[model samples]
Target: MTHEPSGLKIIDRFSISLVRCEKRPTSPFGCKVGLRSVIIHSVLLCSSFKKSRKYSDVGKLNKINFDSLKRPDYVRTLTIRCRHLSRKESNPAAGVFRDFRNLDRLEIDRCHLKSLPSALFSGLQNLYSLVVKNAKLSVIPLDLFAYTPNMMTLDLAGNELRIEPYALRSLRNLIHLDLSNNSIDFVTNTLISLTKLKVLTMDNNRLTNIDFRRLPKTLTDLSLRNNFITTIHYVSGSVRNLRRIDLSGNRLDFIAGSGSINMLPPSLRQIDLSNNQIAFIEDKSLAELKMLAVLNLKDNQLTELKVESLSGPENRLRLLLGRNPFKCHCGIRWLIHSTEKTYPVVLDLSELNCSSLLNDNQKLSLTVADQRNLLICQYDILCPTSCICCDKPVCSCRSSCPPKCRCYRSANMESAQKTRNVVMCEKMRFDGSEEIPDTITELQINSVQLEQWDIKKLQKLRALETIRISNTSITDDQANSLYSSRVLMELQLSSTNITKVPSNIGNLSQLILIDNPLTQLTNGDISVSEIFPQSLKLEKNQL
Candidate 1:
């Protein structure tokens, strides 16, 4: 009985049938010559396999013979670090790795593999790629990618997956599908029918909501960063070949006023929404994103901002607005006038200061001429009756005036100005019932057309200091007859048509000119310091 067709005698009869089945062989032609030399070395290694070996062979025995089957044609790739197999020791009937049909690539890092046994890779059908990183698998077998139909890439990143719902219904020719740092909350509908999926990393997981409308419509790239999103409505009408979306550290405060990334599809560019809490962003929410560029909105709470909120200047946006709370006022003066004409290099605006107007002062950059000189000093210090007389009493008005006024009291300098202290009626205007005479201190009747002062008129001015009738057409009974003057100090009237502003002017307390532009500063002709009031100052003659 002679037989020897050296492929080294078919590796010495497959190493003596694994050393006679590890010495458990009870003779009988030693188990029929080790099953006929493993069916003639698996038919000479499946006729020298490789039509890229289609998932590597699980069906080619052709009446097994060759003195007892024993095939294994030089395995391709199969790493397994941190391995912990067990389920009765990875049973293929406990023959672990019984036959690795030309395995393509199968790494199993940090494995503890909880469950997986449905012909685990049924003799490897040319598996393209399959990494199970940090596996702690909770549940995955639903025919796990049904014997690798040429899997492109499938890394189950940091797993604990409970994902089931056609758990990847046989990976439809998967492209790249990393289940990133998993603890996956939900993603059903057969994992969005992997329609030849492009790249879909489920970042950080625990997702609050994401309905990419039944995904896999050739998704471009998506990451759902640090989950638990408050509201995003997943780009509305189905991902239309989405480009890129991260959604940084979610809990989004706003973004679903009816989705509208200009109705996406234009191959969306990129979006993050950094550290979400987004205070406001309406203006057509990214107005027709004509292929959006990039937006972050770092550390939100944004006081005010508008560039159509994000898609103005015909869509070539680039904004960040670093660490918000920004209230330099007048709605951030149109982002400092559109960051000096369109995205001034993605507008960082030097870490955008102003957290609730200048506190201890200093951070103020914003220029379009400082937002039009702060809306023209908040409209000439708040309009109403622009006034500012000075002849002593720079601000907290310090009394001292003139008396007895019938008008011409010259008495040849009446004994060198006998007790009329000092008065400087700077921006003057007076008429009828003229009893302001206590030898008037400092009265600035700016813009006055004093129709007919009533409400007991300045109650016979005792020792008035500074009084400004800013842009006046006065009446609140003439500002409660100059706030019932009890040694009147400083007073101002901003932009007139006074609707309300007399609460006794906080009882003057040596009042510091209360900014008065009379409100409704500016919105259209685009000026009034862009709409000022970081705390009011206005003096260029009230612009």
Candidate 2:
């Protein structure tokens, strides 16, 4: 017999019998057995031998299988990211662990992962960091991070994670956890279990409330901006190690509760609460913040502001109060007056102004000096005789004629004068007559009992520069004809019975007066330069 390359051989009956006899002691057949029994036994032995040989050949082929050849070696880091994977295709990360076993860090960004697989990080026992950013993941598996005991950082930014209780129960060793740009509405106990967490960013979420007591003690930075939080409470000095807190764009009206400000660690240097509904702030709420440097309160519903609220012994604060409705009245008059001198570098005085105190009769272009004088001298007339005695000489008075020469008598006489030009008249009344004085450059008819004015015939006064008809019963058309003088520089019709002003008033090339009772003024073809002359001056009676 000869061996073939395919390991097949054809042997004669004599040769088979000789081999069977040689191994008969170990076989079940004996030498006394006939040739028929020997041949059958020999054939059975050969068949068993062939089957064993076939199994040996298959064992060699199994050593070089295609699966083992494709398996990658253990590496220090592994990253699998598929950005263009559509929803119809299978998730590429499903079988990514077939090769990566000793991976220390894995980062997956912008992938089409609908849901996380169970034990995704099981084989990565040494994984120190895992990041999944911008993935369309709606849910996180319970045991996603069970095997990664040494995970130091876990980032799941830009996902739709519904943060519930015990959502992150196994990541106890996490140092940094970022769940920003998600739709997380609540923060539960599982998030608090990250005792080793140093930094956490949960910005731009839909969180309306938060239990500050469950915050980690080691947290240094926390961001909760762009949420529907109307108030921030339930924090009882638990976050002792917090350094920075960002609560901008929340709906906070004010900071309430005892120890709420004290809960902030001394290391806290910045707090942003811009674009909120804060109307008022107590002085004591910010007195404890010694280390606070930057405070933003930009857009709020503040009608009045007191700088003393933020003043302290060692004040290191930079405040922002722009875009707030600051009423420029007695409450904020001092601030408007001293803004240039006292807070030259502190407040943004350019953006601060009176919103509601000024009447429609008042000009919007009123300067700080103008506001100061207007506020000091109210609409009430101060009579010098009220503080004078007959025995003492009237130094401020020009002359004394008779008992009827008193200020009230003179004012009453002035009120009865129907002529448009009455310098001596304390109040002038118009009855629709054309008799207007030509020397009238300044007229004061404020709060008088005047009912009618024939302004169309009063055009004869070419020298009329200012006309004050505020707090009167003049109609809109009457006011328009009164201010149509080509030489009129200032006109005041505030708090009058008029509701609108003629657009042709802008055509008065030298007109500058705009103290009207109307809510809006439409601009005409005339430019502002032509309307307001260089000699424009608004008087108290005009406003």
Candidate 3:
């Protein structure tokens, strides 16, 4: 055979005799260059050919591809590009790729191959990965991966089409499957047989629902971003090994069965439900994800957050609720008062914009704006010699501490701080014999003898807002109680006398000064804030 000056050979040069009426498959390009020229091009592309040249079309990302090609090369990995295999030009001879058994990966990119030979991948036994991106492929045959049993990854992105049932049943060893950016409208058993699958990315598709109970339990990460998904039905029996799940940018209004289901697999660590239409989440929903460390709810439809929702034991959890329409009302007092420590809660309060408070036009930083928003106080509690102010917007001679600490509208006392209703206590002797009742809001004992305060059940006052004991050294339990509440807005105490302030402080109450005489200051020691009560009648012997 003779080669042309351009390095391409003509079919006529090979003297390949053709019968007058031989049956031949038509190529979409119109003309058949003959099997001889195709073989010559194959030799040119072979890596073992010492004189073979490497031809690459660099700027050809802009170039359109034609279909129906003969074999191009015999390499360890085959990359078939720029071919438009329409139904009329679908050549069965393309099955020649099956001869490349040593091939480990296959790429059919940027082509219009609407149909492929069923046996196209039949001989690629060692193939490890298969990629068919932007190929305009509309359907995947059931046995497409029949011969590639060792395949571990299948990336079929940008192929908006349908998949035959059991399409991937043969890929038993597959661990990663990506079907993103497709137009698939439904999903069936196409993935039910992948018992070993680990990572599945089905983003940018048209999927509207997902029944996790039908998926493989071996999955560790599953991403379904940017879809039309409105529901994700899951049971505890599914995804027992899954750790990370992402369902962002969907159309879900709320998490189905998120609450009351002790059914989420404990293996869960991260959940991303961001950029959706979610408006509310129940506390049990938060509790269902028991071991979760990260929860992202950014850019959603949430307006209010109940403090009780985060009363779970996951202290290390980092909740992301930014970009949502959060109304800064008394309903969110649990976060403002920092009572999270009571139930052990911490949130990623960064970038959380408040929509209802202050300037609605300008977004408020949740972390920075929280302090100013929570300056509300509502009690004029009469304290002891070492008094505490539980909740008094304008503290004075009038004592108004909550009698029993009841603000929560819900039966859950865990969120008592969220409600505006409050009660402050009056001065009472901490007579050890009284066995301080659990209902008291503030307990002020002016007992002088150290032995006088030990008889009271200080720890039993679960609802107690403040404890004022003077001239007595702090005990570990009492110190813990005080450390836990010494800084409480109602139990206001000077840091000069208090020890290390714990990092986990929930709510802080401000001293509300109502109609009363100004605090009489004495030396720096008697700062206006140090006075037990502005209305306390000064005895002649004391002054």
Candidate 4:
């Protein structure tokens, strides 16, 4: 055994030897002479020494003299961190690692390297894994790995390299390759050489297209997220072993069913198509994926998704349908009726919103139970320009004052019975050609312009019980027929052009005639009101 030099410490514990070559200013070139070489020969010669060496915070002068190492074949694993190597060597990386013939695993991190010499890895045929991450490498020479044909795993992520054809021809046994976070816009011919690749990740790149026919048939997991790809083309029998595929964050607008545009492999277990422009998925598009478990379709433009589209052999599928602008219609009945026995498990139902008949906008879960009556299959009955017609239970109706004058169902009113449906109109201009459904028991109108014929139509609502109109103009003749409703209990006529109160004003329980042009309230009006015993609101008037 050689004597230990200054700044070089040796620790032996439990058949494991650690040689640390730390900095010493007095030593030549800021490092102990023969520090790493001597440690390798002395410590590695032992029968119990581990074959792994880790160099931390390696400085410029603590250069690893690979040529001086006596037993390079004994070394198996080498990891270097924060070691900024100079680019001036004729064969920069080859000169550093050429002697480690028996090296199996090597990892270089945070080196800030911009380029690699053509003969960077010229003599490491036994290498199994190599990682060069967080560097500024722009290009990988086609023959860079010609000497390392047995390498199985190569991760060159976080670089600026644009892969070229035959760049990885030597890696025939590669199993996992990660080229994520790079500037490669096109890789049409770069991966055909890796025949045994199982997992490949090319995330956060500029790839615009992916031809699945060119992918290795042995692949099981492939992720191409955050790319510019508009469509994926997959020929039959290609990528048959693929189990998980992530094609999220793209511009895919539609997914056609089998025998159509894109045909997916049947062995897939997970498919992620979130955050795209997908508006439609053809019926049974993904039904063939019998083994699929997780289908993520969140953050898209889907208006309706059918349950049959997600059919599989088992009930293990979880459908992700959040952040989509789904319309409230019978087309979405599949989602509304999704159950454990009927369809796949749905996630984020509360995060989905839709425009429905009764409510313009509401959470999808709120309308699921009442979807049968709320979601109309088609718009057979057209409403006026500013009106919306919704189906409600035949419950008694309540009227709200402007500017929110929408009608709603109320069964707790003092003088009401749940008899017929109601249609509340706001800012409506009736043309008399339109027929209000005869099933309404209450009619509330705000900012409505009603004609003479329109009044005749309302006068015949046999179930009419409440009449509330505001911000309108009415004549004495119109008032006569309006206040003459036999079943009317409450009447409100505010902000109107009426000059006189109806002769039968006292017939109602509640009267709101404010904001009118009445100049005089005749004695008959007050005396009739006092005798009939009603609630009156006559504010904002001239009387």
Best candidate, lDDT: 4
Residue 355 miss distance in model 2 (angstroms): 5.0
Q: Could you give candidate 3's per-residue lDDT for residues 28-59 as a string of tens digits?
A: 22222112122323323322221211213322
- Which of the predicted structures, 1 or 2, would earn the higher TM-score when compared with the native? 2
lDDT of each: 0.53, 0.54, 0.55, 0.66
Candidate 3 weakest ten by summed lDDT: 61-70
The positional error of residue 252 in candidate 4, measured at the CA in angstroms, is 2.0
Q: How close is candidate 4 to the true structure, as a TM-score?
A: 0.66
Runs with alpha carbons beyond 4 Å of true place in candidate 4 = 1-59, 62-64, 67-70, 83-95, 258-263, 312-316, 339-342, 355-452, 459-543
Cα lDDT for residue 532, model 4?
63
Ranking by lDDT: 4, 3, 2, 1
Candidate 1 residue lDDT tens string, 307-416: 55565334557777787766555556566555555542346876776632312254455543243243211111111112243343452232223232222121112233
Candidate 2 C-alpha lDDT tens digits along 40-108: 113343333233222222212321221232222323443434434434222433334434455566776
Model 3: CA > 4 A from native: 1-74, 83-92, 163-165, 256-265, 311-315, 333-348, 357-363, 374-543
| Local error of candidate 3 at residue 125 (angstroms) | 0.4
Which digits, one per residue and each the tens of the lDDT, describe model 4 over residues 133-203? 76667778778888888999999888787763366777899999999888878867557667899999999
Question: Could you estimate the TM-score for every candidate?
Answer: 0.30, 0.55, 0.56, 0.66
Cα shift from native, residue 314, model 4 (Å):
4.6
- Cα error of candidate 4 at position 380, Å: 3.1
